[model samples]
Target: MPPPHSLLQLIWLASPALPVGGFSYSEGIEAAVEWTGLDSEANAAEWLSDQLHLSFARGDLALAAQAITAWRAGDAQRIRTLNDWVLHTRESAEFLLQTEQMGRSFVEWLKLHHADTAEVFAGLPATYPVAFAFAASRTGASVHDGCLAFAFGWAENMVAAAVKAVPLGQSAGQRILARLANEIPAAVDRAMQLTDDERQAFAPLLAVLSARHETQYSRLFRS
Candidate 1:
């Protein structure tokens, strides 16, 4: 088990109340709702579930796992490589902005508690996952627990987005959140099992939707 203080830190990091601007972006979920009419409770749950298993698990989750290892080892080069992958692999301008904006915000938040964070990430364009990994590395939690925290943070943010975009009630949102909670461990397992060679960020449909979302007629979320 992780240390008590570390566990608390993880919970804090996972909280939606963190000032990371995670609530502003729906990660193309709003666009999915607009373009694909993904409005029902069942469809939203399935959509988010598929995204968790397909796109997120294969991409950012895996990247964060590797990045946590790199941060722990003080491997600046590996961290750079991972950050570069995030920058280049973003499917759309909004997606790119979401990661970069949230990453910068998270770093600034870290600076309030950890003085050296600014210097440590001085020259690097740290993406969300990489910056988050750095914070996780500072905790006494194991890599697995850190990743769980990261994934749950993401799931909470996405579910909130779904609640608004799908127009679901609180109870429906809780059901979706419960479903995602059950699936997170398995998703994390797959993310951790991936090799650098096997890591990928290829979700063509999501990319297309995100691109279309940039010009979406009406929208509530940023991406």
Candidate 2:
């Protein structure tokens, strides 16, 4: 088990109000809604679930898990490699912007709490997962638990996006959150089990929609 204070820190890191501008991005969900007509409650829930498993779990979640280990070990080379991978694999402009902007924001927030943060990421273009891993490493949580926090944070943000883009009621949002909550542990398990070579970022549909969202006539979220 994690120490009590560490557990609390993890919860805090997972909060939507952490001020990393996460609430401003729907991570392609807005595009999915507009382009694919993902309007109904069931469709929204299913969309998020598939995203949780197919795209997020395999990509950022696994990367963050690896990055947590690297940060704890002070492996600067590994960290840089991971960060570069995230930057290069971004499928669209919006996707790239979302990761880079949130990463910069998260690092800035961390500097307020941990003075060394700015120095640590000085010359690197940290992606969101990599920056988040640095914060999570300080919490002394196991990689699995750190990933749980990460995934839940993502789930909350995406569900919020679905609520706004789908125009669903609060109850529907809660239901989607509940479903994601139940599935997060399993996704984290898979993520934690991934080897460095196995991590990948391949969500073609999400990429296409995100590109479309860049030019979307009306928008509620950044990506």
Candidate 3:
């Protein structure tokens, strides 16, 4: 169980403004738009909506929830194993690099705030889910909030990408965001039930697109 102060810590850790460089990447949405001719706002929205519902919400959030549970149980080895496995499993080199970069940044930021007690967890992969769990556990956040936050954060990035690639109006983006809020709770619930192994996702098409984006003469995202 997390102490009260730990909950506040978790909130801070998960804040969008934490400077993790997550905003720069669209998890391959950029490439999808460039290569697949998903150029229109409506086309981008539908594709993003499906991808969010089918892939990220169902997969990554589930893994992150499991990781949070493991972290709360003080299972350091499980945390490391999960993060490393996720790192290797990511098919795109750029996507893998993005996660690793953010993970390392999150851990480094946490280190400056934690005392000697958290030093061991510091060197772990610091994957987004692992970091989210570490923050939640340390801050006393419930499993529910951690999972929701993780899902919401991921969902928002997709929405952000939609806003950019779709070139949707700001109000249109906000509308999409509002519509998404209704889906998140259910997604979080589904995620809570998954085990680490079950969290695996093989998004080969998306991976190939992302890798291809690397050689695209003009690219905006790191992955």
Candidate 4:
């Protein structure tokens, strides 16, 4: 199949090579693995699939869909509102740091490589989801397509984290990612259908895990 005009850019935005420091965050997965004995490929896959469906696909990606639409329509106040929601809903300091830093990093990436577009964000807080929405609005993909890219990027980074944290093999990590890929499209579809009121960062155990990770005796990932 031929790439769309912005497919390559979509792919780039989703790439682990984007220098957003996404490499440093496990989003509580590391701590969960340590505390919960998520030591096998199957265990890792199950945990991630649950996270995809329960948290990310519903919450972050939904906001991304809204933010993307707002950005495309040049709605600055809507963007700020979404950004504030992300900040206020963070369940832990580590989680908050993870999103904010990645957001700032993504924004800086936009500024360096796509200045004209980044200029729209000069005065806005670009939390990861919102910054992602801002950058993804330029992709020209349907919102679902853009959400798919976001989901895959998240799965890839997360699989890498599982490999290191769970100490799984490369093949095990690949298997976990494969399972996540199978679930992502449906998750993205569900995300696309959500209203702003339904979006929430409401994972209780995940929050506890993330807070514990902040002072974890020894840790590889930041959150």
Candidate 5:
């Protein structure tokens, strides 16, 4: 089993303020608003809510939970396989960049704090969730906690994106975040139970919006 997790470390790693450039990409939200006419706070809230349940929980969160187990068990082969799966499943080029950049940044953070295992992670093909799994593995966080933190971080970033792109007020953003938070626990629970073959990230709308976002003339997000 892994060592006891530091609550502070989990919070810190999940913070949007971390230097991972998470704040820069709207994860296709910008494109959804501009290209697809998703222009209201209510619309944004619903979109994020659906994403949390349909895409994130069923896909990345499950992968992260499984990977935390692999990392804790010192199963390097499983870790590499998980990493490759993430790389292969990205819906678009920009999505791929977001995962790779954030994964690299997270591993760099790990290097600063845990140099010994940093080299191990650095050698693998890092995707954001995969890198996060390795980071959480050291913390001995339960799969639920690890996936919750990951989802919370993604929620914050997405809310920040909406606040900027949809021009939602800060209060509106908080409300959105609150709604997203309410869904995290259940999503985490579902993710923890998924087997590898059951995992999926195939959100067609997100993929379409992401591809359109890449060439959008007046875009505010990376992907």
Candidate 6:
């Protein structure tokens, strides 16, 4: 470990306000609300929490851990393979754009900090998950810690969206976040053992919702 408080450094690894442009996208929550009957703040929160466990948190974090392991081993080829898989598997055009935009933006900032590090790309060829993993691993965060932080960030983002979309009280949004804390550990456990071949998840519901959001009358977030 780098030091007693080295874990704090991981905070920088996945900062929501980083140049990665994360706030510009709502990770399909907007679509889920518009298409499904998940219109209320409470319903949106529930849907997002379930999604955090079943799909986004599980699939992305696993790939991130794998990328971190490969990066640590100095296996550039494996890292590239992980990147390629993300490129192929993130089927939605909007979703792919979100990941690639965030990944490239993250790489731009990361290279500023990790210059001279082997294979550090000026533009990340890896997906957002892998980029996040590499950044956290480089900063001495444990794989579990990294994954949880990643999930927490997205969870919080959904809460923000609920606050905007449903006229939910700020306190209610915080309560939703507190509720997610209880569920994250079980999801993290599943993410740790997730295999690349098992990356496909039944999240087509969100995809369909997102496609519909493009035509929805009004929305709080970009799909």
Model 5 scores worst on lDDT over the 10 consecutive residues at 1-10
Model 6 weakest lDDT span, ten residues long: 115-124
Model 2: residues with Cα > 4 Å off, grouped in runs:
none
Candidate 4: tens digits of C-alpha lDDT, residues 72-163: 89888888999999999999999899889999988888887676855677777679989888788887787777788888999999999999
How close to the true structure is residue 188 of candidate 1, measured as C-alpha lDDT? 97
* Per-residue lDDT over 95-114 for candidate 1, one digit per residue giving the tens place of the 0 to 100 score: 99999999999999999989
- Where in model 3 is the C-alpha error above 4 Å? 1-11
Q: Indicate the residue-level lDDT of 39 in model 4.
A: 85
Clashes of each: 1, 1, 3, 1, 2, 0
Model 6 gets an lDDT of: 0.73
Decreasing TM-score order of the candidates:
1, 2, 4, 5, 6, 3
User: RMSD of each candidate?
Assistant: 0.7, 0.8, 2.7, 1.4, 2.1, 2.3
Residue 78, candidate 4: alpha-carbon lDDT = 86
Where is model 4 poorest over a 10-residue stretch in terms of lDDT? Answer: 1-10
- Among residues 3 or more apart in sequence or in different chains, the pairs in candidate 1 whose N, CA or C atoms overlap within 3 Å are 28-223
Over 1-223, each residue of candidate 3 has an lDDT whose tens digit, in order, gives 4566755665566466777777788788878877787776567666766666677766777777777778778887888887887787778888788878887777777777676536756466677667766766665678787776666676677778767764677887777777677778877787777766567667888889889978977766676
List the candidates' TM-scores in order: 0.98, 0.98, 0.87, 0.96, 0.95, 0.89
